[model samples]
Target chain A: MQGKAVVPATRRRRPSSPDGLVLLLLAVPGIAWFSVFAYGPMAGLVVAFKDFNVRDGIFGSPWNGFANFRYFLTSGDAVTIIVNTLFLNALFLSASLLAGLILALMLNEIRGSLYRRFMQSTIFFPYFVSPIVISIMLQVILSGVGGSGGALNNLLSVIDLPQLSWYTEPGAWPWILTIVKVWQLGGYTSVIFLAAITAISEEVYEAAAIDGASRARMALSITTPLLLPTLGVLLVLGVGRIFFGDFATIYAIVQDNGILFPTTDVIDTYVFRSLRTIGDFGTTAAIGLFQSVVGFFFVTAAVLVQRRFHKESSIL
Target chain B: MSTTGYNESLLDHEAREADKPAARRRARRRPEPFTVASHIVVTLFGLFCLIPLWMIIAGSFTDETVLARQGYSLFPNPFSLAAYELLFSGQSLLNGYVASLFITLVGTILSVSSTASLAWVIARRLPWISRPLTVFAYVPMLFHGGLVPLYLLVTQVLSLSNSWFAVILPILLAPFLVFITVSFFRQLPEEILDAARIDGAGELRIFFQIVLPLSKPILAVLGLFYAVTYWNEWFMALLFVSDPDKYPLQLILQNLIANVTNATSLPGATAAQAAAPVYQLRFAMTVLTVGPILLAYPFAQRFFVKGITLGATKG
Candidate 1:
């Protein structure tokens, strides 16, 4: 039966006809999914411009014509949330990049397989668990008098210093969140840089070595200079996402803790609270639409910049 | 410049270590200040990653009173399984496990297959459909209808408030992964595909029999990415799932941790709150939730590393 089928197919041999249709058939489910889930919600973005009510559907709702946008813009929460998002993402972005580059350079210098692998594995271990797990685990160490003095407090008291409430202090969270982001993503990012460094060809290092360049000096002069493009690309990509925040990390760790919201809350968490808790769709969608439009411009600019830098690298 | 630079270097390093005189290598390598400092710094960073997790395990074993007093020591003083006892005493944990497991398994399979099928279409770049399809997929990556509509669509319109479909369907296809997989597929030996076509094999047969078999590494990596994502799905559950029994492990962990924090942070907490073993239970819950991912890390490490590097550092 297979042989006979093959014989007929061979005789027919229509290159694009059979494959194209079957391929389209294969793609129907995904297209439908994207349409309903992705584009459907996109069309429903009209809620940003409407006084949305659950009863009157998204389209049936009265068009408010920038009232939602105006309300959000005038509302004091706009500047705070937008500033918080940019500031926090900026902290995470720079810290992770620096941490990743340093770790990568260090890892690259180590030729011993076992120790390097062990360190790589250990550093990368944090990526496996969610920030919720990390935050909970570290809470034991970071807690203060209000929550039963944790390890840091214990150490501080031993040193005749004051025990600080880590969680309640909004001032400490920006640095705390930055540290956590580095700890979680540092290893993963380092591995990427290491891959780039590995492809730098042993000849470059050997040639520098014969020229009497020290390892540290070579790393500074040779490796760091070579990493500029990657660093720049990552920076541009990070800029594109400046309006977004690590909602998962923030929400998981902070979890409706109103005390930390002033510093830790970003546009994402704000929108989430509005949609879920406050039940304010019009204002929330207005904020969402704002983020989307601004985010689209940033992304487009990033792609354009990337295309100018390396034509083949642009997503567009 | 092969993409397997890290793996190849690792193998090369191992072989060198095996054959070379370690005593000689160490003697030469010992005096370098740079090497010494890097070893110390990287080693400390490694310990920094492991210590908190280790402390949590130790804290889970410690008695609640001891934990409160000492703030989590390396060895559990007056070790007690009270947290374990409390954890196993409920059916909710089991339900969390079941829900998480089912979703991760089913969701990863569906996501990966959908991604692969769509990715193959994009990779083929047929004149008529591929470009439009590509735009349809990629546009969502940049701008999407915001959370209000997504929530309303899932909850009110689709009425999937408590269904697993609500969570899985939203994230079923990632354009980023589709693009990466498309790139991977496009690099295949086209001559083999051409030969198969000339020999009267249907495109479907060629894809199933040859292309997919050849695409295992990328698929495995992509599947691992999806599985990790599905396993860590808490945000969607927060949005859609309300039934405690249906909660994923992450949502359970989030709620459990939140409750514990609330309980502990109360001013002049009642005796019942103090005696509840909240500290140990918190750590214990974290351990249970993270246990599987940690266990799978060693096996999945290469694939995970490959997937990220492939996606992020590509030209």
Candidate 2:
């Protein structure tokens, strides 16, 4: 009976047909998900082509060809906005990675398991805090109002320095934002790097110890080199996202403060203000398209770089 | 029984550690003492995380007038419930809180269940669909057309603008949640799925009765993740809803903070009262807003630590 069933099964291949259908079925949910949420809105990109008007609506808006794109490129603030975005992202990305790695290293050295667990849990709580909350917290801390009103400003006064208007000051924002980003994200990022660190075989450390290597020396020579692939992947992902910004945080914190626009206005915030405030959908979409395309290209480049360095371990 | 067993093992570990010097003598030399500087460094970093939370709590309790005068102290000065009193005063605040809770609860349940079902199907390696489906699931994570188009799609195209559905539906089919679910399903043994099939069980029956029951760990993780995301979400509310009644707690808190920050003065009061700090109010509101999550997190800390490690470790 088994032999007879086998011969028929070979002829019919029941699993193959239904399994193929199953794969097709699985694709349906994901495809449908992206189509509605990710790709469906892509049609609105056409608003960038037309001189968009609320009266005309998104689709019925009149075509202005490259006029929007031209306007965006020719705008006086374009260079300043683009450069500021790139600069801030570079600062933020590098600072976060460094801070995260340092924290992970510190956590790894912790002697007691309970203490290590406690530290991990406590530090990671901030990662879950909303960006809006962080913005609110920072504003209160930095507002520099005196006679008990100011946090940082009061500290400055005690040291005989003038209180800086943090909200108004563009110069100090880059540093402040970088620090804020690091504080919130470092704990989260450290977990990833820490996992990579722990996944390193204990036998390798044991071997190095037999060779009379110090813990610090072993960490530098053995652990860091081994963890490079993980770090490389992280770095590439960050690089890929350089064109886009964390709009929620930046918009909530910075708002319409024009003085800070030169330092704090990223592509996301710029496009947002352009769309909402100026009612320039076409130009804003053009800028959005520009960021997306550049982001795609850079992300592709980063993946390629990761593949070159780490081969199969690279996410790409 | 298992809890008692765990305690016994922990006690055994203590006993073994107590004999460590005897073992070390046989090994010729003990490892160097842990560096004192490392302890200092770790302690400082731990305090860095703890202090902000303490300040937020301190600020929330501190009298608004005294807070205005004192800058934010770790110690609550002239402690009062003024901020809390004012925060909960408006009907909209109560409505926002209710709306947020309902959305988060409903959204997390629906999102986690659907994602897990799909993940179970994909993880079984049905030989025909897994690879391509996995690729399709990951694409949304990397590329998205900017916010305007997405917003327009949600509001105008889908006609969900100002509707609670606007925030809830779009977030329901999150790609990250699906990916997390898939990673979890992959960790489950194929034999269980095969055994179900051999028992002549249908896919839906097997999933609900068997697959889901065994997936508590991942479910807890993904549920918590999606819950937090839904709770903290305000940008969606800001974009889609104009009605204050429909706003989530985050958005309500955010608007209040924004208003206070921009107010520049408490103009109705006398000069001395006006001079009293207002920035603390924003901090206070933020503290009140995040209070629920902070209170809840300690209980779930173990789950979060494990869940986060699992989520990020693979990706």
Best by TM-score: 1
For candidate 1, the C-alpha RMSD (Å) to the true structure equals 4.3
Candidate number of the best lDDT: 1
- lDDT (Cα, tens digit) per residue for candidate 1, span B183-213: 8787776766766765766667878887887
| Model 2 chain A worst lDDT run, 10 consecutive residues | A1-10
After superposition, the stretches of candidate 2 with alpha carbons farther than 4 Å from their true spots are A1-30, A144-149, A308-316, B1-34, B125-128, B261-281
C-alpha displacement of B16 in model 2, angstroms? 17
* Alpha-carbon RMSD, each predicted model: 4.3, 5.3
Clashing pairs in 2: A23-B129, A148-B69, A148-B70, A148-B71, B68-B277
Worst 10 residues of 2 chain B by lDDT: B261-270
lDDT of 2 at A148: 30
**Chain A TM per prediction:** 0.92, 0.89
Determine which window of 10 residues in candidate 1 chain A has minimal summed lDDT: A1-10
